[model samples]
Target: MPEKLPVYRIPDFTPAKALSRGIHVADLQAHRQKHAFVQAPHKHDFYLLLVVRNGQGTHTIDFTLYDVKPGSVFFLTPGQVHAWDLSPETEGTLLFFTPEFYRGNREADALRQFPFFQTWQHPPVFNVQPNSLSPVEQLLHQMQQEYSRAAPFQIDALRAYLELLLIQLARLYPKTTVASEENIWPFQLYQLETLVENHYLEHLPTSFYAHALHLSPKYLNELCKQNLGKTTTDLLQERLILEAKRLLTHSPHLNIAQVAQALGFEDNSYFGRFFKKQAEITPEQFRQKR
Candidate 1:
């Protein structure tokens, strides 16, 4: 049997009850003092941000190890498995908030506007130069201070600070070592990814994504080809296959038919054929190996 993955509900930490109010902040040092375990694999019900101001270790997310150093930032979207890799002396700020927090108290903005928030398509780690992180640090410090105090309109203040942090990080994202192809996806591709994120379960066709992005299927294919060396259908299948793999690997109680139904396939036999075509194995076989 596969090891059961640990899934955490909202407010993973003791102080995270504050997260229910919209935003919460904690220091790594305080966390270590409160709990005997410093690092264990876990997933969150909300988004998470960690900025390592002075640290040297590895932060692993979804089986990928990202080097942790001063000015390193980690972004974790909901459902991502992550673990801390730091020492007792390591120091950093951890922030948690839900999607509702983003839409509350202001005009709604798409979380997808930031690169790091798009964790499925992008690496969740960013290595910012120390000299360039002063403003970012100032914003985080203000958020921490506000979260700790009884200031009026506290959620408002936290929201402003969080928005600033996201904007600053988004600006730095394009300058990072992301693959050249990632930078070239174009606005249309960005919209396509957003669409897939929302509607992949519908089992929609490439034309649906093309129409939503207001491009013809040919142009969509062209854009994908130019940026990712893949066609629109290929990209869409990649997203669908990814979700299928997630269900197959994690939802052990679900039978193959249930997995098919959950992913919008009505026919178990059809789903089996589709999975085999894309994954080169039966869903059961894939789950066993994983």
Candidate 2:
């Protein structure tokens, strides 16, 4: 039987450098291939825009899995855990860029206005119908060709083209208007939920957020339930449990107490009960079986 591949950070890009401003198109695809870049559920502090030209599989992001098909486009923002399970024959153009790329650009910010880019109550999935894909296909082909050309201002040209692509995406997406039926409280709660998920390692209590957001504990709970369908405590517990599971499955060498401490649990016994209650087994036993 083949052994399970250990989950680890995808190797940092080679040419062995970072993209301070922009990257060439071929380098982007080659980086995906060179890193054995079948990413396991992970998050980054940057934006990723992927246009699946030819591929079919599941792409998991932040506790959700999306179906991938030809011409499907997906947007991932910073601090969202995502993974791609693509066919060996998978073909796609994935652009990774910092939020700074779109800094001060109104049209680029407009892309974030869509619900598809938010921490959704439902999964974010889009399938391109035949009649609606010409613009995106045109953009992808143009990006590939422009990237290959040797010109003095090629990087600047790529940036302009990429921004134009983002603008088209904003137009193709449905807009969000502030309707009377929509509650602002839920939006606030979701924003808080994202903060906790992204920084739970800091091991903050609910009061910290309440204080930060200028609200009380009771009000926070109400808002969370209304917006995200979960209470504040429920969201915190879920985040902790998910991280625990990731460590158990990915970091096999770590023992039970080590795992507990890594998750900011000062009381080992309490951590065991908390995990067992959610998982129905003690951590050590859970690790052994899995």
Candidate 3:
């Protein structure tokens, strides 16, 4: 069998302190040298914010390729696959934090409130305009300093800076429809998305998630349509298709039948039909093309 895609935890990079804190910050070039394996496609259990001060190459998230240059900012949530190909001269900063660390004492789903963190809803990459780069650059520098220091309430200090950094990035995120705190739809949608993420592999029905969110199936569909331009079923199917693609692309040893079984489809033929309907190609064709 092909090796399982590596999933890294924050502690993997900073074994001493990250186990307890669930956060780590590093200078980009040194981080690249120290963890060269990161260049290979892998997943992370923690969230990642990579701010590129200067770089040249491509950062691939899921199947999308993003250009790397000065002021490029990328956000990655847990379980997403990503890899970067950067020049040796690349210099920047990387912040890795888990949802628990970012949430602290706030709402449990605090990190999901940001559009960038909603990987299903928005692309995870953006560029910082040079004119507006100072504040963001300064925030990253402050975070690095705070992370490196040995001081009282350091976690709290780091959390505060992280929150500020997220807010700053959210403001600059392009054409995002970030809802106000009082808005219920966005939070409800986020909750539904979270539920889907957890249960999609089970092939659960849309009503299952609707009931979990205390909303009727029809209203849930309406909310998804209004906000995401897709139905609840579409979200579930799209997620399945994405995972199918990932398996097809990364797990060369898994034959089509095994991939189908892995994805909760008992019938490999049915899985092939479903994939073609949603992805516009057969599993074999997709794998070969990839």
Tell me the TM-score of each prediction against the true structure: 0.78, 0.72, 0.94
- Which runs of model 3 end up more than 4 angstroms from their true locations? 1-3, 18-21, 176-185
What's the lDDT for candidate 2?
0.65
Off by over 4 Å in 2: 1-11, 14-32, 37-43, 60-66, 79-83, 104-112, 120-124, 141-190, 285-290
* Superposition error at 253 for model 2 (Å): 2.1
TM-score of 2: 0.72
How do all the candidates rank in terms of TM-score, highest first?
A: 3, 1, 2
Tens digits of lDDT, candidate 1, 1-290? 12255665545565445545566778878865775443776667778888888868888776578888988888988767677767656788878788889778556447866778754357888787876888888888888888777878888878888888989887777554344653543767667776777888787888898888888989888988876777887877776677677667667778888888888888999999998999899998998897
lDDT of 2 by residue, 190-280 (tens): 5575578567777788888877778998898787777677788887887888778767765666777788888988888999999999889
Q: What root-mean-square deviation over C-alphas does model 3 reach?
A: 2.1
Clashes of 3: 0
List the candidates ranked by lDDT, beginning with the highest: 3, 1, 2
